[model samples]
Target chain A: MARLLLLACQATANTVENEQKSMQVAAVDTSKVSTDAFLKNRLEIVRVDKKELPDGLLKVQVTARNVRTGFWTQLASWFMGDNPYQIAYRFTWLDIDGMEVETAASTWIPKTVIPGDTVRLNAVSPNPRCKDFTLSIRENDAARG
Target chain B: MNTKIISLIGITSTALLLTACGPSVKRIDATGNEGLVTVDEVDFKDWQIAAEKGINSLLASGVLNRSDGRKSILMISTVKNSTMQHINTRILTDKIRQALLRSGKVLTTTAVGGNGPDDMASKQVRRLEEDDMFNQSTVQKRGTAIAPDMSFSGEIVQQTSSQGRMRESYFFFHMALTDLATGLAVWEDNVEIAKQGKKPLMGW
Candidate 1:
């Protein structure tokens, strides 16, 4: 009985560790826009565009393309190339001093897109002090929150 | 009681007890994917999504940046809720206000607005000029308060339809920023959210 309990505890710990790793790996920064998402292997970041508007706010537009796989790899019988993934993204604004500039709209925004399609996420600096930004992308779980 | 009635009562009590032993409450990221969602209601995540979309549109419109090279003064106006749900409109406006403030392109007037002063202290402090307890030199002058260059207003509308056992809802967030002097909308945008779920047999 004691040995069984130890094994169960180890299994629980492993599950927790896997969850943490998945969440951490899910976030892909714009600086590493070339890298694909570890959270969902199908989603790939194709292009990243950054510019300053007339009002001196930094705007970053990230384009992500979804790559599709077979039914066996997806683990589903239905495979018509229309499978959609709910993805969430958040933007963090950093000032000249490298401090985060918090805005009320700094919450994650969720979007649903099908594989073989592209998702464009755009965000502007909430403050003029924010000269730099970091974008985090992850899979959105609607009912989990 | 009949056997059917007795079984019904026993099942109801057991269900209630099970519900009472539901999961414990815990804090989660408000903007993340873990928020509660209802097919017919405007959830917190919905408001967040709408507010961010509205802010992005407003900023990208370039209406806040005037040709005079000065920050525009803005007044917060009423946002009519035409939806069935009772929504605290501030949850939507406050986010836009905060983002605009951070952008440094617009300053919201607290002394005057469509619904009157946001901060009553603005007027109460100025009223001290009439009082003798304080020096009148430090008091705010009448002409010192600047008028807003633009007015912000919006409406939340919803449309619902049922198809078989599934119910679908579409919420539209329509917002506009008007030029106070020109009396014309300088910028306008709309954000829409569509959700469909299996309809419950009972209450909404």
Candidate 2:
């Protein structure tokens, strides 16, 4: 009977350990474009294109490229087990008169930028507010806070 | 005659006592169903967590407050369920809508595009007097009806991968807030929830 109880205790401990390990989130590089000071040092916003949406509103597409391949590439390599990873871009919109729209309609999102991949983000003008736009890119930390 | 009657009563009492002491009495205690351990694919606590997470994220992101001069009126658009199970995505979205309204950031209208028609019967009833006044030429025109300033639309996708008894199920919730006039998505959020479990053997 004592041996049986000891065996059960061992099994319970093993199960607890496995459960803890399984619940752990695989580490992914959480450096956001707006937050990472180090990456910003090496990467530069190369070109941005502005176009009129079908409603005659303007959309700005900003592309950023890394000047040095070392740090950014190394960070991407660290995100091995992160699945369904997404990169979100926040767009602050201004009216034709250059006033912020101040609505929930300002945030646009993009996902999954692998290593050495050029990421594209779209920022649309909310109707009458599409007179001008500014795009901010941030790397999403996996639901930490 | 008195002795015979007493004996008869005693015999009946003994028989009744024996009947009460039978195996059926033990069967009543033997049939136990409480505290049974079982495994389910989606537990009630999971839904509770998912609902709270979805609503909190949507609210905290300030998606509902983005109104352009207009009072942020929202219409529930479409919630596509891309899961193997026939899960009701509306249950999740409704909780989010209610939370948004409670936050005073936005209000949802039934009339706009959703899974069904908006409940306008109450609005219609209230408008009848105004309609009558307009018909009698007492008023020049009907009051301007408030239209939804934005539309809420999104999808729920689920992926399940398992190795033997160990199973991992992932659910992704994606939502977008779009401006009606420009058809541009202003706010978008995605939430991923995953659960892991080992298969139950035999009784469990």
Error of 1 at B136 (Å): 2.8
Which of the CAPRI classes, incorrect, acceptable, medium or high, describes model 2?
incorrect
- Which stretch of 10 consecutive residues in model 2 chain A shows the poorest summed lDDT? A11-20
DockQ of 2: 0.02
Q: Point to the candidate with the largest lDDT.
A: 1
Docking class of 1: medium
Question: Candidate 2, residues B1-204: lDDT per residue as tens digits?
Answer: 999999999999999999989875223211111122223243333343455545545554554554363448888888888877767776666766665555455777875567665575635554566564455543323445567888888887888888988777887878788888899997787877675667777542
Question: What local lDDT score does residue A71 receive in model 2, on the 0 to 100 scale?
Answer: 63
lDDT by residue (tens digit), candidate 1, B1-204: 699999999999999999999998999977666778888999888999999989988887778877878888998898889999888888888888878877788888877766677888877888898899988888887777888888899999999998988988999999999998999999999999988898568875
Model 1 misplaced stretches (Cα beyond 4 Å): A1-40, A69-82, A143-145, B1-23, B200-204
Candidates in order, TM-scores: namely 0.79, 0.43
Cα RMSD to native, each candidate?
Answer: 8.7, 17.6
Give the alpha-carbon lDDT of every model: 0.74, 0.53
